[model samples]
Target chain A: MLTKRIIPCLDIDKGRVVKGVNFINIKDAGDPTELAEFYNSEVADELVFLDITATHEGRKTLIDVVKKVSSVVFIPLTVGGGIRTINDMRIMLEAGADKVSLNSSAIKNSAIITDCSKEFGAQCVVSAIDVKKEGDDWIVYTHGGRNKTNINALEWVKNVEELGAGEILLTSMDKDGSNNGYDNELLEKVNNIVNIPVIASGGAGSLKHLYEALKFGKADAILAASICHFGILSIKEVKNYLIKNKINIRL
Target chain B: MPDISILNTKSANFHSVKKAIDLYNKQNIITSDINEINNSKGLIIPGVSSTDTVMQNIKDLNLEKIILDFYSSGKPILCICVGMQILFENSEEGVKPGLGIIEGSVKKIPKLKNKFKVPHMGWNQLELVKESEIFKGISTNTNFYFVHSYFCDPLDEEIIIGKTNYSIQMCAAIQKNNLLAVQFHPEKSGKDGLKIYENFNKMIS
Candidate 1:
């Protein structure tokens, strides 16, 4: 049996780790390379470095940051943002990224997922979705949740899997930074519709939230930011809480 | 003639073997090329430093089909440490799809079971699970070096040829059809380990 993964997501802007309340009010957290090294020592099962500005900046892969983080951290590292082509995926993977997450890119060119998977394998590709409840329907958000796709969140996830995505990083834009908890309804819906592993991101306020995500949502992994970044909770604390709650985590 | 090939990427595992192979080539022991692979006999698949990057690196080098091709040709392939894991359908370390050439999943030795520090780094013993060509002439319970925490669990039990009880009855080696893989590092495992290599050499000879 596979142990459930606990991941810390580092939101990066101009190579610096930044955190915001609901994806705004950006504040510098620390040096990405330094923070990544810290998490690496904490036995973080995996790390995600999202270039929050890459989409707006029209950049390619986060080469320099990826190089710096990959050099120091031996654990699995994933990078997202501005990954538009197979070449971008190749660069990130060559730079030592274990996987590349596609958000806006997947919506723009679904074919990119298939092509990248063929070249780099499905496991190397991840589909990141920022979902927000739009009245009765759960709408999929793209370009960092600035625009809404007409597709339902569950259907969109299914489409990504069909395109050969190995995993789904589902984030609740509405519950993000609210410290409420994960969107169980949305997660359960997506989890049921998709067979691939779903990593619940966005609303992780407490260790209990993580437990709920794993237990109720059946999430294969959880991605947390503020609670972990501001030192309110450490990875060790989170893992300990999960263990006490009878949840499986890499000790 | 057997169609053999080397599978690895630019990871640390790939680096060491690449260095070793470079030394062999510099000494005129062998030539490095896929076509030459068929002439030379058995294949050499090196380990990945961690399970995380295996899929990308393997896909980056276009190794899966190449491996399946070798398997279909009935050539014996030796998977080193993590290389042995490529045989499984999946790994707990990553969400990547394994070759599934062997019917099983690769899982990390449960923390509840592991007494030794992970990465299992150093020489250990291989308690032969059963008698087979891979272990012929080698002592049944001879000690061979090991450095991995994850082991293969074949869906078909008959393929498991050897085991070592460290924290669990971990698989030391496997043989399914023409395919063979070992969780231990043969290149670093010293003489007894080399005997297993010698057996593989004799198979293709």
Candidate 2:
């Protein structure tokens, strides 16, 4: 049976993890390497390191962090943010990331996803879409939910899959900091359309939220930050809760 | 520059496997290529990860016949980690069939009641269960690094040369005909690990 993964998302900037209340007002969490080792000890099913630094030097710093984290953590790690070229994907993977998540770069040049997937493999490419509700429809947002694209969220997801993305890491820009719950409506919309694994991200406050995401939303995986980074929910505790809820977990 | 000689359909990082070979050769260990085993030189196929997938990969590359040819020639073939598991009949992890060089299927260590991790993930000692050229320098309880979730259950019990207790009488090493395999990482297993590779080197030499 395929295990429902429990992932912890780390927003990295300049080799340090910075967690924000709602993607703003960042607070230094710790060294990226240390956080990675901690998560490995906690038996996180997977880890995602998003390099939020938009500068060239920041990109170099992110690669350094990836190399450092890979040496310590044995579990799978995925790195993203500011990745523009296939060489970037190759370098991050060679640096120890099991997968590479592409957001803005993918939106800019969707062919990169297919090209990278062909060169590497589908299992190694992740397409992250930031979605925010626009009236009766969900619109795809880029630049970390600041600019809404003309494309619908569901349509973008389908496009990504057609482009050979192995998985979709869907983030709800609306419920992000509210912790009200996952955008189940949006998740279902994308889930019904894409055959690849769907990882729900943003707006998970408690275990019940994760349950709702997997149960009602039918997400293959859950990606949370505030809940995990702030000790509101540990990966083990969440997995245990999910198991009690009859969801498939590695534990 | 493609550094990997074999494009594994599963794990394509042939560079790392080549690195392991280069590191072994630096220690004065002679490693034989897969194409040369028929002429009497032994061949080493060390697998650090992905037993089931690697087996599928070999079949995908259409190289199983060549491997069976090596086995038929009575040349020594060493399997390391998951590589050892592929020497068996099947594995529970994937639907792909193994080489059937040995008689058993690989299955996960039954869910243990205690906290000994599934992949084992670290170095542990190998206690000899029988005599073979592979265990020449390795002593009783000699530590060798291991990282795997599945084990081989050779149909012929006599071929089980050594056992390492993780959950069951796990086959640490198996020897039959000219085939030898170990469930530990020799490249990362320190001096003793190097000797295990050296023993293989001697066999092939």
Candidate 3:
């Protein structure tokens, strides 16, 4: 049986961890490699380095980060944020990143999805969608949640998958950082529509919420940040809780 | 002489495999040169792509003869994921014929009413059916990272050493003399996964 993955997402800016997170007992909390090694020890299925760096130098630093971390951390590593072109993706993939998450670029040019998928295979392409509930359904938001698009969340997910995205990283903007819980309804709907894996992000306040996302929402994986970053709960504790509840976690 | 030559399959990713092997012995080199690979004590063909793409690259690089020559020379070869699939005669995912080093066919994972994803992309347990030097310290039912849609249906069931369950009871690892191949990526399987590389290195020494 394929075990449900528990992933910890690290926000990176210019190759440094964004938040003052002290989750791991490393000397440098901002160091991406150290945090990655710590998480790998904690049995994190995979690690996500969301590079928010805008400058070219910062992106170069990200490549170095990927190289250093991948050399030590022998788990699947995903680098996202600021990946706009095939060249950007090739640079990261060549540097040892197993996968690259496409957010804004995927929306702006839907062809990039097919191009990346064809050039690098679908498994290497992750379609990240940021959404906020409006009226009866959710709407897609780009530019790091600043620009609103008229695209419907459910419809866009299907489109990306059809365009050859291996998986969908659905983050509910309404629930993100809210600590309320994941949008199980939205997750279930997306899961129902597509056959690919769907990673539930946003509002994971408790272990029960994680359980709900996988069990009720039928999510294949969970992308968590604040819960693990702020030291609210350790990954081991989350695994223990998930195991006790009969969840198939990598133990 | 190079300890091991990681075959450049041009499958988009193999550095993780190289880095994993580096922990045990840094003498490995990722190369496409036939002479270097032929001189190495061991060979690892790591791949992550469709059968068609990997096969196309393998054909373009003209690696079939060298791989077959190395196999016949009794130098241990480790094939991973699509690398493992390429050993068979053909695959359902693509039109290109495989190297046919191993007599078998690669079949697509059935949807089964969409109970599981096409690409079995995650950590799954390995049930060892037979002992091999590759899994020296690894235990049965150990989890390993796997990412592929088509599973190899080798005609010789006796060669299978490991089995993992996803859509059905499928072949995960196989051993035929000095050749060892696995559908799962031990490089991305973390600590336990690293043991496989260590064991392979020890086999070389």
Please list the residue runs of candidate 2 whose C-alpha ends up more than 4 Å from where it truly belongs after superposition: A20-29, B1-11, B14-205
Q: After superposition, how far is residue B120 of candidate 3 from its true place, in Å?
A: 0.9
| CA deviation > 4 Å runs, candidate 1 | A20-29, A55-61, B1-205
- Candidate 2 chain A lDDT trough over 10 residues, lowest sum: A20-29
lDDT of 1 by residue, A63-129 (tens): 7777666655555578898889898887787666768999988898899989887666566789998
DockQ-based class of model 1? incorrect
Fraction of native Cα contacts reproduced by each candidate: 0.00, 0.00, 0.82
User: Can you tell me which runs of candidate 3 are displaced by over 4 Å?
Assistant: none
Q: A3-35 in candidate 2: lDDT tens per residue?
A: 567788898877778873221222334677767
The TM-score values for the models, in the order shown, are 0.64, 0.64, 0.98
lDDT (tens digit, per residue) of candidate 3 on B159-183: 9999999989999999999999999
For TM-score, the strongest prediction is 3
DockQ for candidate 1, please give it.
0.07
**Cα misplacement distance, residue A139 of candidate 2 (Å):** 1.0
Clashes of each: 0, 0, 0
Worst 10 residues of 2 chain B by lDDT: B1-10
Q: What DockQ does each candidate score versus the true complex, computed on alpha carbons?
A: 0.07, 0.08, 0.84
Deviation from native of the Cα of residue B125 in model 1, angstroms: 20
Candidate 1 per-residue C-alpha lDDT over B1-205 given as tens digits, one digit per residue, 9 for 90 to 100: 3233355455534333333333223221222345566454567777645555766776876666767777788877777777788778888877888888888898877655222334343334577777778788887666554555578888888888888765667787888777888887554333455566567666765
